[model samples]
Target: MSLVKRIRDISVATLNDKIENAEDPVRFIDKYLQTQKRKLTELEKLYQQTLTHAHSVKQQFMEAESNRIKRENQAEVAVKAGEEQLAKLILLEKMQSEEKSEQYRLLYEDGKQTILELEEQIQNLKDEVQELVDKRAFYEAKIESIRLQKQLNQVNRFIEKQNYYDQSRSIDQKFSELEMQTNALREVRSNDTKTGSSFGGKLQSEVDAQFQQLKKKLEKER
Candidate 1:
């Protein structure tokens, strides 16, 4: 193979290896399909070349066979005319043509078999590549689904925590308000009792003073 052809083969093989071992199923599958396409393209080129070679070989064999037949006919004619030397030359040429034809035929047969093997290899490679692509898609979808589920779970947990914190803060505020109200009420009651006791003591003192004045006035009039 030429350098360019060799490089192409190596590229395809490397891509195939990467596709086979990729962790991301989606990427692996896509790349695998791409590699298979490339491989098929290369195989197609090889098939065309094989076909051309086979055709050329067949053509050569056909020409050689025709020449051989003509020489044999010429040799028969020469023998009837009693020209032994010419007939001998013709027979020798016929044998050589037959040998060349046989050689071309064998080469053609070999080329044909090689072409068949290459085609079969192409088919098998396509089937295996397709199978791997499908598996990659399936695994990728499964991983995506699991990833989404995990994200949703985290969001739900965060929301629950937020609600819990809000409720806790609300309860604390309400309890603080109730405590203030209770303290206010108690203070009002204490102030009221103190005011009432002071008024009662002042009223009793005024009544006693008035009674003493009346006793002193009565003694003066006597």
Candidate 2:
């Protein structure tokens, strides 16, 4: 397998970029969404590549380990058969394979870590995009509510002005009833003024008021 260049720092912090040409909240959200999508797509592709590279490294490590073990077994058989020269050559090959395995193992581990970080970055981007979508929804609702409330206020003002005569007529009728009650009370107080603040006289005057009302009713009938 061809050697791959190491992927350095892959942080979501690096994903942040200024959104341009946005006029309003919604537009800002739109532009931000576009940028995030593009970043997510690229990150995902990178993740796949990283995954494939890690697998390649793992395969190489396994192959090198297998070769080392095979050579070690072959060397042991050669030594048992009294072929010391052959055993030395096999042992040397085994050492080379062992070293290669160690190197590949380290690379595979590094690749795995890179893949994890890439996955984390992708998820973070997705979460941020979702958060922005929620904010856009909230902003849209608030903007629409403001527009509706303005229209409602205007309509209510016009309708309230239209109802002025009706409300005033009702108020005037109540005022006239209050005025009548006030005049009756004034008449009572004036009539009681000559009674010299006598409680019994005031009580008797109130009692006589009912009879006066009955007499007025009888007069009306006649």
Every model: Cα RMSD to truth:
6.0, 16.7
Which runs of model 2 end up more than 4 angstroms from their true locations? 1-23, 161-222
lDDT of 1 by residue, 1-222 (tens): 544456556765776577557777577677667877898889888989998998999999899989999999999999999999999999999999999989988988998988887777676666667766777777778888999999999999999999999999999999999999999999999999999999989999999999999999999999
lDDT of 1 at 25: 57
Scored against the true structure, residue 88 in model 2 reaches a CA lDDT of 100
In model 2, the clashing pairs are: none
| Candidate number achieving the greatest TM-score relative to the actual structure | 1
**Per-residue lDDT of 6 in model 1:** 62
- In model 1, state the lDDT of residue 169: 95
Taking all chains together, each candidate's TM-score versus the true structure is 0.68, 0.63
Estimate every model's Cα lDDT from 0 to 1: 0.85, 0.83
How many clashes would you count in candidate 1?
Answer: 0
- On lDDT, the candidate that comes out on top is 1
